[model samples]
Target: MEALNLLESFVRSAEAGSFSAAARRLGITPAAVSKNVARLESQLGVRLFQRSTRQVTLTDSGEQFFQQVSGPFSTLRDAFASASQDAGKPAGVLKVSLALAFGREYLVPLLGEFLARYPAIVPDWHFENRPVDLIQDGFDAAIGGGIELTEGVVARELVNTHIIVTASPAYMKGRPVPAHPDDLAVLDGIVRRSGPTGRLRAYTLRNQAGDEAQVAQCTRMVFDDPEAMAHAAMLGYGVALLPTTHAAKWLESGALMRLLPGWHADNGPVSVYYPSKKLLPPKTRVFIDFVVDAFRDREFAARFGAP
Candidate 1:
C-alpha cells in the first residue's frame, strides 16, 4: 500500500540521515523520498522529523514511534524476504559486530558451523572491545552482553550471564576465603576498569540475613582487559570479578577458584541486536533463529556450566 511505502521511506530516510542517501539506496530521486516521508507525517498526524538545510533529526515523538514500529516492520520484512527466496537459498552479506572476548570464546566457534550451513551467505565479522553504533556504522547485527539497543533496533535475549568473584589457589593459600560479600573489603581485589563505568568494581553480596547488599569499595589493582585481570588473579594478584562463562573453563581446570559463591552478581542476559529494517535478509533471520535455538537447548547450560 502507499501508506506502507511511505512508512518504509520515512524509516530509511531517518536511518540514512538524509533524503539524498535514502534516495540513492532506494533507487529513487531525493524529492520523491522527501515527498513520501511528508505523506507519512501527514497520515500519522505527527511530524516525525525536524529538517533543515544542514541536518535531519528525529523529533521526540518520532523516536518513540520508531522504537515501537521498527521491530514489527522488520519482522514483516523478514517474512516477505523468506517467501521470496529462490531455490531455497539465502543470499546476502551479514555484517556483525561483537565484543572481542565473547566473540573469541563463543561466537567464533559457533560461526564456523553457521558459515558451513549457509554457504551462500557472506558474513563480515568485526570484533572490538567497545560498542559500535549499529545504524551509523552500517552493521546489520551485533552480539554482546549488554542490551543497550538504540531507538530503531531490536534485541533478542539469548542467555543469562552471571558474574563470579574468583582468585587463584596461591592467592587463597594463606588467607581465609571470603565467605560473604562484606568480607571482600579486607581481601585484595583486582578491578576491571572498562566496565559500565571507570570506577571501582562493585558487586552484589548477601548480608547475614540472606538479603542482597552492594559492596562498592574495595580494590587493589586495576586493569583494562578482563583477561589481564583474570591472569593477574591467577598470579595471586587478587580476587577478580568475571563473567561466569569466561571463568568456567578455568574453574573446571582448577586454575581459578570461585570466591564468595553466594555473593556473585546476576547480570540480566546476553542478547543479539540488529537494526530494524523493513525486510530482514533471510540470512539474518535464520542466523538469529539458529542462535536462539542453540542457546536455549538444555545441554547448553551443562556445557557452559551455567548456574
Candidate 2:
C-alpha cells in the first residue's frame, strides 16, 4: 500500500500552499514535509509541484492526481470517523502493562468503577516490574515510571515518582534509626536489581533543600520488584528504598516508617503511554483519562513525594 503519510504530506502541501504551512499542520518540520512529498513524487514517477523561492504551486499532473485522490480520501476519512465513533463505545480487550505494586494497590481498585462505566471494555492488565516493548509486544498501553519515549508513542504524565527508604516497626525496634545517608551504611539494606540492566539500582537521595547524597548499600538481600523488597523489609530483612506509591499504604498502616523523612529518591514521572494520538480506540482512551482523573483526585504527585 502507498504510504498514507506521503499522501498527507502532498495533500497538506497542496492545500496549505507551502511546505512550512503543511509542516505546522502535520506536527513535523518543513524539511520533513518536503522530503515526504518528494518521495511520493519519486514513487509515482511524476513531478507534483512547481517550487519557487517563496511558495509551491501544484503542477498539471499534481492537480489531476489531487482531484482523483481527494474524493475517495475524503470518503475514507469519513468512514474512519464513523468507525472511531463506534469504537468510542469501549468494547474490546483493553490490554495494558503496569507497574506491579502500583497496579495492585492503586489502579486495580479503580476497575470496578471503570468497568461499570464502560462495560464493553475488558481489562486485560499485565502487571510487571520492568518495561515492555509496547509496539512490538502489541500492548495497548503501559503505566510506570521511567518509560522510554519512542516514535508514534505518546505519554501523558500521570504523577511524580520517588523512592524512600522505609522499614517496619518490628525491624526498627531497638535499632537506631538512620539520621543521615551515612548512617544507612551500618543498616542492613534490601536492594533492588533492575530487570533490564541486571545491575543493583543505587539511588541518589535528595532532601527538600536540593542536597544530594549517594546511598551506601549494605545489602542483605536483593529483590527484583519493589513489592518484593518492601515485603522483605516488612519481614525484618532490611531497610529498603522503594517507590512511595508502593510504600504509602504501608506507611499509613504502620507496616513501614520512613527512615529519613526529609529525603527521597526522585524517579521522574509515572506516565500512561499509548501507541499514538490519532484515532485512539475508545477502551484505551477512556482508561488513560480515567487514570489521569483518579491520580488528580488523589493528588498522587504530591502524595508520592516527587512533587
Candidate 3:
C-alpha cells in the first residue's frame, strides 16, 4: 500500500529476476507483485523492468535506481531487525560456490568443523573454477580468486594468491638453471586458460624488489584447471607458472621445484565474496569470518609463499 512497499517489491523482483520469485519471498501473489511494480513505474514515469516470458531484467535507468536505493534499503531492514532483536539463529541452506581445487584441498577439510560449530546451518556448496554471480544465483557466498566486485557484493581477503614458476626436477637435470626470468622463455611452458574469459593466461613474473617481467607464454600444453596444469608440470612437461598455494604440496614432496624462486606473478588475493554488507545474513557472515580466520595465518605460508 505504501510507496516503500512498492519499491521493496520492485527491488526483490529485480534481484530475483522474476515476479513469481519476489512474490514467494514476500508471501504474496505474483499478480500483487506485478501490480506494485506497475504502480511504481507509473508514478516514476519510467519503466523499471523489461518483462519477458523467461526473465525480468532491469532497464538502464532502473539499474541506476537499484544501485542507489538497494544498499540503503537493506541497511534499513537490518536496522529494524536489530531493533526488534529478530536477527535470530542462522538456519537453512547456506549455499556457497568455490574454486574446485581450493575447495577440495582447503575448504573441504574445514567443513566438518564448521558444521559442528553451526549445526543449524546446512551446507549447500558448489565447486567450480569460474566466477559466480552471487546475487543472481542466490548463493550465500563464493570463494576464490579473480572475483569481480559488483555493486551488491563485497570481497574479504582470504590469502595472497601469488604464483610461482616451477618445473619437475627431472626437466631441469640437464638444462641450465634460469638465472633470470628471461631465460625461462627457452624452456617449455605448460600454460593455463582463464576460467572466466577462456583466453590463454600469459606469464607475468614479479619480485619482492618490484622488478617485473612478462613473457608471452608459448604453450607446450594447455589446461583449464590449475591443479591439472601443476600435474603437467610435475610430469616434466615444462616450466609452469602456478599459484604457490596450489603448488606448495608438490613442491614440498619434491615433485616440482620452484624456479626463479625470487620471481612470482602477483595475480590477486583469494577472497570470500558475499551478497552485501547491509543485508549480510548471519549464515553468510560467520562463514566469511570462519574462512578468513582459517587461512589468514599460517595454512599456506611456510611451504607455499610469503604470508
TM-score of each: 0.71, 0.71, 0.75
Candidate lDDT (C-alpha), each? 0.77, 0.83, 0.82
Candidate 2, residue 188: how far the Cα is off, in Å: 0.7
lDDT (Cα, tens digit) per residue for candidate 3, span 1-307: 2977898899899889899988876779999999999999999999999999878999998999999998777777555443443347665668899999988888899999889988878898899878888876667899988878998788888777678888999999999999788887789988888866889888678777888898655668888888988988888899888888789888889999888878887767788898776556677778888888888654654455632
Q: Is candidate 2 or candidate 3 better by TM-score?
A: 3
Q: How well is each residue in 1-307 modelled by candidate 1, as lDDT tens digits?
A: 5766787778777778888877765678989999998888898899999999865789999889888886676576567667767676886778889878877887777877888888888888899877777776667789887747778789998777777788999989989877667777888878877565776655675433568867654679888777788788888988888877778778888999987765556756778898777677778888888787877863445544333
lDDT score for residue 157 of model 3: 80
Clash count, candidate 3: 0
Residue 105 CA error for candidate 2 (Å)? Answer: 1.6
Q: In candidate 2, which residue pairs get closer than 3 Å at backbone N, Cα or C atoms, i.e. clash?
A: none
Give the best candidate by lDDT. 2
TM for candidate 2 is 0.71
Candidate 1 off by > 4 Å = 1-86, 194-196, 207-209, 302-307
lDDT of 3: 0.82
